[model samples]
Target: MKISIITVCYNSEATIEKTLKSVESQSYPNVEYIVVDGNSKDNTVQLIQQYNSIITKWVSEPDKGLYDAMNKGIEMATGDLVGILNSDDTFYDEMVLQQVANFHKQNNIQASVGNITQHNEEGKTVRKYSAANWNPEKLRIGFMPAHPALFIKRELFDKYGKYALDFKIGADYELITRFFLKEKISWKYSEITTTAMLIGGVSSSGYESYKLITKEIAKALNRNNISFSYTKIFLRGFWKLVSFLKKK
Candidate 1:
C-alpha cells in the first residue's frame, strides 16, 4: 500500500533539513512525501525546494495555523494511508514506515500507532512515550497514542473528518479521542518507535502553552462526551512528571 507522509513547517530552516533527510531515506519505496510550509520568512522554503525531485508535492504559503497546514497536506494526499511528521521530528529509523506498512497490511487494520521519543535540540532523548497497547477507555485519563507516530487510512479521515481547526493545541488529542472513544475504531499498535521528536514543540513550549494544552485536552475530552475531571488530569500529569524525572 502506498503511504503518504506530510511534514508541516514554518521558519524551520534549522531543523527542516534533518526532517527532510529522514523522510527521503525511508526504505519504503511506495512512500509519498509532502511538505506544507506556512510561508516561512526564513530560508526554509529554499532548503525544501532543493529536494523537489523526491517530494511528491509541496506548497509554501500562509496558513491559518499548524492544524490548517496539516489539513492542506491531508487534502493533497492521494495514497491509501496518511501520516503527519512534524518539521521538528524525524523517523526513528529508515525501516519505521516499512514496519508500519507491513504490520498494517498484514493485520488489515484501519489505523496504526507506534512509539516516540522526545529529544532535545542536541538530539539527546529526553522522554519516551508509548502505550502498552491500544485501549480506547484510556482516553478518560488523558492517555493517547503518540500523534506523530500515528498513521491512518486515508478513508478514515474522509469518514471521521480531519483535525478540528477550532482546537489550537490539542487537535490531535481531540481527533484521536473522537476516533477511538466516540467512533470506536479498531487500530493496530506496533511496539516500535516511529518518530524521534524535538521537545520544544507547540504544546510543550512553555508553562503557558502547557496549561493551554491541558485545558484544551480537557475541552476535547468533554466535547467528545467522555467524562474527565481535573483530578484525572492531574493524575495523568503526575505520571508524566514521574516519567520525566526517571528519564532525567
Candidate 2:
C-alpha cells in the first residue's frame, strides 16, 4: 500500500527538520510525503525547501490554523493510506511507516492506531500514550487514540468526512469520535509505538487552552449524539494532570 504522510507546520523551523528527516528515513518505498505550511515569517518554508527531493508535494501559504493546513494536505494526498504527523513530532523509527503500511495491507481495515511517546523540552520521555483500552463506549467518556500514531485509508475520509474546521484544539478528537462512534468504522490496534511527540501541544499548553479544548470536545460529542457531561471533560483534565505529575 502506498502511504501518504501529511505534516502540517507553522513556524516550525526549529523542529521540522527532525520530522522531515524521520519521514525521509522511512523504509516504506511507496510512501508519499506532503507538507502544508502556514506561511511562517521564520525560515520554516526555507527549511522545508531543503527536502524538496523527498517531499512529494508541499505548500507554504496563509491558512486558518493547524486543522486547516491538515485539511489542505489531505486534499493533496494521492496515496492509498494517509497518516498525519505534526511538525514537532516524528516517527519512532524508519520502520514505522513500513509496519503501518504492511498492517493496512494485511488487515484490510479502515484505520489503525498504535502508540506515542511524549517528550519534554529536554527530549526526555514524559509519558507514553496509547489506545490499549479504547472502545466504542470508552469514546463516549472523552478517550481518544493518539492522533500522531493514527493511520487511516484515504477512502475512509472520503466516506465519513474530514476534520471539523470550527474546532480549534479538539478537531482530531471530534473527527476520531465521529468515525469510531457515529460512523462505526472498524479499527485495529497495534501495541507498537509509532511516533514521538512533544509535550505542551496546542491543546495542553495552559489552563485557557484546556478550557477551549473541553468546550470544543463537548460540542463535538453533542453534535455526534454521544453522552456529553462536564465530568467527562474534567476526567480528561485529571489525566493530563496525572501525566504531568508522573513526568515530574
Candidate 3:
C-alpha cells in the first residue's frame, strides 16, 4: 500500500533538509510526501524547492499551528496509509518505510506503532527505545508509542475524523486515546520500525509546556476512568530514562 508521509514545519531550515532528504532517499519509492510549512521566514522554502522533484506536494504559509498544519496534510493525503514524520525528525534509515509496509501487509491491524530512539542536535543517539506494547489495559495508566512512529491506514481518519482542534499540545494523545481506547481499534506493534525521538520540539523546550503535558495526560486518563497520580507518572517518566540503558 502506498503511504503518505506528512511533515509539519515552521522555520526549520537547519533541519528540514534532513527531513526532506530522508523522505526522498527511502528505498520504498511509493511514498507520497507532503510538507506543510507555517510560513518559514528562512531558507526552508528554498531547500524545499531544491528537492521539489521528489515531493508530491508542498506549501509554505502561515498556519494555525502544528496540529492545524497536520490537518491540512491529512486533507491532502491520497495514499492508502498515512504517517507523520515531523520536520525536526528523520527516518532511522532508507529502509524504514519498506520495513513498515512489510509489517502492515503481514498484520491485520488498522494502525501500526513502532519503537524510537532520541538523538542529540548533532544526530548522535542520546536515549529512548521503550517497549510500548499496545493493549487496552496497558493504556489505562498511560501508554503510547512514539507519535512519529505511528502509521494509520488512511481510512481510520476517514472513519474516526481528524484530531480535535481544541487541544494545544496534546491533540495527538487525545486522538490516540479516542481511536485506541474509546473506540477499541486494533493496532500492531513494530519492534524496530521507527526511531523514538528527542529533538526538543516546542513541547520539550520548557517547564510550562511539560506542566501542560502533565495536566493533559491527567485529563486524558480521568476521561478514561483511570486514576493516575503524579507519582505514578513520575515512575513512568523515570522508566523512560531507564529505557535507554536496555539494548535490544
lDDT per model, in order?
0.87, 0.86, 0.80
Candidate 1 residue lDDT tens string, 1-248: 99999999999999999999998899989999999999999999999999987799999999999999999999999999899899878999999989988898788778888899999978889888886554877777777888988888988888989989999889999999998899888787778789999887777677788678778889988888988776777577787788668967
By TM-score: ranked, best first: 1, 2, 3
User: Model 3 scores what on Cα lDDT?
Assistant: 0.80
Expressed as tens digits, the lDDT of each residue in 64-160 for candidate 3 is: 8889999999999999889999887888888999999889889999888887788887778876655465565555555566788889988889898
Q: lDDT per residue, candidate 2, 1-248, as tens digits?
A: 78899999888899999999998898889988999998898999998999998999999899988898898999999989899988999899889988887787779688898999999879999888877866766666667888888888888888888888988789998898889889888889977689999898887787788678778878888889988676867587687678669968
Cα distance off (Å), candidate 1, residue 88: 1.6
C-alpha lDDT (0 to 100) for residue 14 of candidate 2: 93
Cα RMSD to the true fold for all candidates: 1.9, 2.3, 2.5
What TM-score does prediction 1 earn?
0.94
Model 2's TM-score against the true structure:
0.93
Regions more than 4 Å wrong, model 2: 239-248
> lDDT score, residue 211, model 1?
78
